[model samples]
Target: MTRVRSLTAALSAALLLLSAAACGSDGDDTPKSVAPKTAALGTLTPGVIKVAVQPYSPYTSVQGDKIVGLDGDILHHVAKKLGLKVEPQVTDFAGMLAGVQSRRVDITIGGVAWSADRQKQGLFTDPPYYSPPAMAVRSGKTYKTVDDLKGLDLGTVEGYVWVKSIQAVPGAKLHAYPDANGVFDDLGAGRVDVGFLDPLIIIAAQKERPDLKISTQYLTPPTAAEVKAKPAYQYFQPYQTGFYLPKQATKLERAISTEIDAMYANGELTELVEKYGGDPEQFLRPDDAAAAARRGVDRPSDWTPPAIAK
Candidate 1:
């Protein structure tokens, strides 16, 4: 009887060991103790919020082995708040978006806008700020509206929101470039009459190359015909900009977004937008609730602007 009892006890202990081994093999539930401090942030890699970045100046330009730009600056602040470090992965614009979606990175930045189509693919935070589309022209040239682009050759980065609207122009030819620098180069070479681009990028380019003798004009919203041709045109009246995040990281996204709202309340957002994107009033304020809805934002009827609104 004593020998039988001993064998039964050994069998029970062996079964328990087997169950624990199975559980240890499946690691989906939590991160290991490598960096327990940032594990709570729910990042793929502990102790870091990996960000996909591009060379779109003033947004994600690399400055001497460091990513120093408006978006990175804001992200660093948020990461610090969460007790994590910012790890920027330099890539092209399209790659940046793809990286986050593929889980290669935790988030992407460089003026990602609020769009219903994009929202379906990944997650977006409430916009950090709003900015109007800008047209880059020769130093003394002026273009007040989209109508002024008629019959002209326009250069722009491929995959921009304004591409279709520029294509809708009755006589204009939309010259697509792989990157913003290409557009700026053609504009400076007089190869293209104007460059349709992000205001922050143009501002950074202006600061970098005074020799280019280029200037920017804040474009008015495209005409109704243009909007009809490209339904995406409606986001152009000073559209909201956000960070793109992987769909699976809901907790991480919410945490970062909460930090952004805190920054607004603390005036850090206001100060950074002014220092980089320029025009505090224009960049810090979103469109009225009515217009924002047209751009695919589901803002409430009684919604009010953030603290930085002018």
Candidate 2:
């Protein structure tokens, strides 16, 4: 009987050990520790992100090989938020679009305007950065409002919605130019009595040529579709810029959208515009530069950046 009891006790001990082993998994069945793998944000990662940038003045430009401008600065901020290094590739305004489509760069930061057409090509983020006002002004007469250009020969870049808007008004002859600069130059030469142009360029031109007259009144509030319709028109207005990602770039798109929202919440975006050329009080949601700067941070010192309204 004693021998039988001892055998039973031993059997119970073995069963307990087996149960423990089965429950514990002996490090074999244990869940393997997932090594902290870095996220694959395409060919780009947390350390370095290649960007396509345009040397368009006020929005983006190259300063001694360093990409600099309101839009470039905003991309730099986005890069910083993502804990990534930035490498900016300078290209022509039209070429920047090609770089992004080819995946030669992870992103483009040259104040690209969002539009329904571009949406067909790839994904875009929410809330356009800036929409600079467009103005209809007479050649030599400084008018204060759209009413001033009511009977004048108002010109707009061909194929732009702004031109359509001008055409809607009776007696408003819409002369289409290949580019805004040409329209403005024509106005300067008196070939056209008036031209519609981005307000900032108008401001810059007005500063340089006081003899040129602009109606103080803006003809229309800028929209992203107008800016995105063509790269050529974008080169003229260049505001209402938004982030562009490859089609179905879900991870990268989500990261950028999150960072942009955080920036808006933190008010860092608002500060950038104040630093650039926009009114802080009026340009909060519709115009923020922080996202533009952070997305393209090429240098350690450029981690903080802003502005696409120029």
Cα lDDT tens digits for candidate 2, 4-27: 124344344434433432453233
lDDT value, residue 252 of candidate 1: 86
C-alpha lDDT of all candidate models, in order: 0.70, 0.55
Candidate 1 colliding pairs: none
RMSD of each: 14.2, 22.0
Give lDDT tens digits, candidate 1, residues 33-109. Answer: 44554576688767667666767666777664356778878888887778775666665555666666667678888
Candidate 1 global TM-score = 0.75
Best by lDDT: 1
User: How many clashes (backbone atoms < 3 Å, residues ≥3 apart in a chain or on different chains) does model 2 have?
Assistant: 25
